[model samples]
Target: MVRISEFQIKDVVNVADGKKLGNISDIDINLQTGKIEAIIISGTGKILSLFGKEEETVIPWKNILKIGEDVILVRFNEKNEFHIQEEE
Candidate 1:
């Protein structure tokens, strides 16, 4: 397993079908296991900020594509990808 320190927040995620999701807001950590549970990403669109919205979508850490020192790449399930839009 890799260390969380190797990854940074606010990194962009590229999904299939050319849908570009937003950046990482925070990370979900498992307190019991002391490991990263998932990566939280902010909702799409600029309108969210105006409405005081703070919705975040969580992608399992295992689904991550790569964890770089500067950014993180993640892949979301295609079928449930639309669920992220409603959460916003």
Candidate 2:
């Protein structure tokens, strides 16, 4: 078993394209079922970051392929576009 805090420290990577998504900034959970729904990745600042226009990426739990000691590997189709939304 791993604590949620542990997830914050591990980097999240996409195995399909070998892209490093970033670390987990938050998570979505099903309170009623006590299950993890998805992992939320905080966006990296861009040139326009000064305007606070970054979007957070959400990775569904099913997309996660493996959780390792230092990284969490995920798999997504080539056409799979990450869900992005304004930070809360």
Candidate 3:
């Protein structure tokens, strides 16, 4: 059983480019289904990062391939066109 605190400490990496995408800041869960729909990563590579990113990267759960002790491997688009679920 993985606790949310434990999940937060791991680095999120893109398997395609092996870029460290930062850590998990939050998770989007489908309350109706009681399942995680996506993981939100801290947006850090922006030029105006000190002012905070315009939007955080929300990676769909499907993109995640592996969860190791210290890192999470995900396969996402290089374009950064992450899929965000429509709000109700």
Best by lDDT: 2
Off by over 4 Å in 3: 45-54, 83-88
**Could you give candidate 3's per-residue lDDT for residues 1-88 as a string of tens digits?**
9999998999999989999988998999998999999999865554444554344688889999999999999997947656333222
Global CA lDDT computed for model 3: 0.82
lDDT of 1 at 58: 76
Pairs of residues at least 3 apart in sequence or in different chains that clash in candidate 3: none
Pitting candidate 1 against candidate 3, the one with the higher TM-score is 3
Q: After superposition, how far is residue 32 of candidate 2 from its true place, in Å?
A: 1.6
lDDT for model 1: 0.63
Tens-digit per-residue lDDT, 1-82, candidate 1: 6544444444655655335566766678899997888877766554536655455677888878876665556777756643
- Top candidate, metric TM-score: 2
Backbone-clash count (model 2)? 0
Q: Rate the local accuracy (lDDT) of all candidates.
A: 0.63, 0.84, 0.82
Q: Write the per-residue lDDT of candidate 2 for residues 1-64, one digit (tens) a residue.
A: 8998999999999897888988999999999998999988887864345556666788889999
